[model samples]
Target: MHRTPCTVHGTDDRDVTTVCRCGCGEALPAAPAGGGRAPLYASPACRQRAHRRRRPVAPTTPADPPSVAPLLAQVRELAAVLDAGGRPDPTGVRVVEDLTGRLLARARSRGQTRWLPWVDAAGRERTALDDGDVEALTARLYADGARTVGPPQPSRPACARWVQAWRRDTSPGAQTYAPLELVPGYPLTEVDARVLVQGCRDGGESWASIAARAGVPVAEARTRWG
Candidate 1:
């Protein structure tokens, strides 16, 4: 290849000129007199470097490590939103929960923990809750033996499942199952409680027994049962 510029004598004329893309301040050689695609690199080494830079990167697996502080902070924010909403946002909660679950699972697989300080609502600095706590909370959101009654849907909390069970058991001509009474100190909806009390009476269970089981006086049970 000719290394000299092909310029007419006594004239400042050139075919083409361009800069290299690799941050190296070098001019690419001019193309021939007839028009053609200009070179993108000053040398073969720069061309090879540019090619390597554009190669596809492999997809990352779930076990990839993440920054601990930001992940924890994100989890805390999600938890705070759940708390402040008073009504749960299941999707947001699940997102952070799954993120933390994967992080902890990866740590456990390597037989180590990534320790970071976390502050609780009581303003005490402590380690994050263990898998057991998450398990317990997760269990509380689902009733044992609950199954889909319709097409696929998002998960419902255990309370929702309980209420569904209660409604089905109390419906006229509906097959009965074990009762899922309301939690103490928080009565079921007025209608659900009424149905429950009436169902008990119709089942030949005495008002006194029903009252005792419900942690209420017999008179209150009779009044509600009507």
Candidate 2:
């Protein structure tokens, strides 16, 4: 008598795999020892299918954009205006100076100082404006009725002259003297002349320093002392 192969059934005793379903004379591995449930597979195809069934990832939201661009652009524009050497309104000068200091801080963080010229308002072509100069310009602008919150207009030549006068008078080492002639029209006092001459002597104050202290032009001081 011929014996038939054992049959496998689902855990619930249902037939999940058809027997020789194709009748192709080929046998497939039985599902499970006691049930028709599919066997756990460790093949590449099984892995790929398992990976596809994993939980879908949630999308991410982007961060908010920065808002300082416009302010920085405005600061750059104001800096350009100051760089052009025009007589700026007092209030405008102050604004420029404040903006310049902030911008300079940023530039310095990046290891640069060339931007100083862009914010300078002193019209000193060879050097950048120092803090004292910037403050002076700003104060002068404020005193001249400059609008506090808008683009500043250029001051008139007279206003510019006034600003220049203020700078000259308040500048360090600037002092006036009278009585003796130095330049064709600049008169120096007898005491001032004697002091100036002594200051220029071999071991005395340097002619440059004396000229600076006396507010005399260097060329005139050198000529008179020599």
Candidate 3:
């Protein structure tokens, strides 16, 4: 029998398998022994080519969506308005509207009612105010020349100075007054009388202002000072 140098089969020492020029390809060196197992190439080039064909390239992850920078900027603006201690500007109003919406949503989620405090002239505090109460207070402030319509401007130095004076009078030994209880003959000292006269002479000449400066009720100041 004649044997081919490059082709032989089945367990013979003389059998040799060359790189197959036929390109059906030799069984890879790392190929699993029969029984339907997969083939693995031993040549680096072949392995790399196989890997490129069989393994998938990873898809790139998407970048994070744009941040909450705009919302944060609006919140900062609202804070600035609050810090100024005046009514909010248009931007601030928008922010407040947004916040109010959020708050209402949260309250609805929690099955709760939002309540704000209301103080009465008798020093009683309540959780609600009627239209009448609001109207009365509004009228009173208007009459006193303390209320202004429309947007607030920066506080004037004169108004600020007046506020400072009012604050000073709230301190210990400073004069203070009740608006409704002023009446004549409510005990007055000589010093009190002198202070009352000076207070009247000062810019605090209104009955309420004079009484406040003298540490007496307006009614009392009018009665005694008269």
Candidate lDDT (C-alpha), each: 0.50, 0.44, 0.44
TM-score of each: 0.24, 0.19, 0.16
Best by TM-score: 1
Off by over 4 Å in 2: 1-170, 173-195
How do these models rank on TM-score, best leading? 1, 2, 3
Q: How well is each residue in 177-218 modelled by candidate 2, as lDDT tens digits?
A: 211222122233554454335423422446676566445777
Model 1: per-residue Cα lDDT over 32-88, one tens digit each: 689888787899999888888899988985642344555676677777876787665
Off by over 4 Å in 3: 1-155, 171-213, 216-224
Give the winner by TM-score: 2 or 3. Answer: 2
Best by lDDT: 1
Misplaced by over 4 Å in model 1 are 1-178, 181-188
Query: For candidate 3, lDDT tens digit of each residue in 171-220?
Result: 32333223211212223355545443543433225777656644567788
lDDT of 1: 0.50
Ranking by lDDT: 1, 3, 2
Q: Model 3's lDDT to the true fold?
A: 0.44
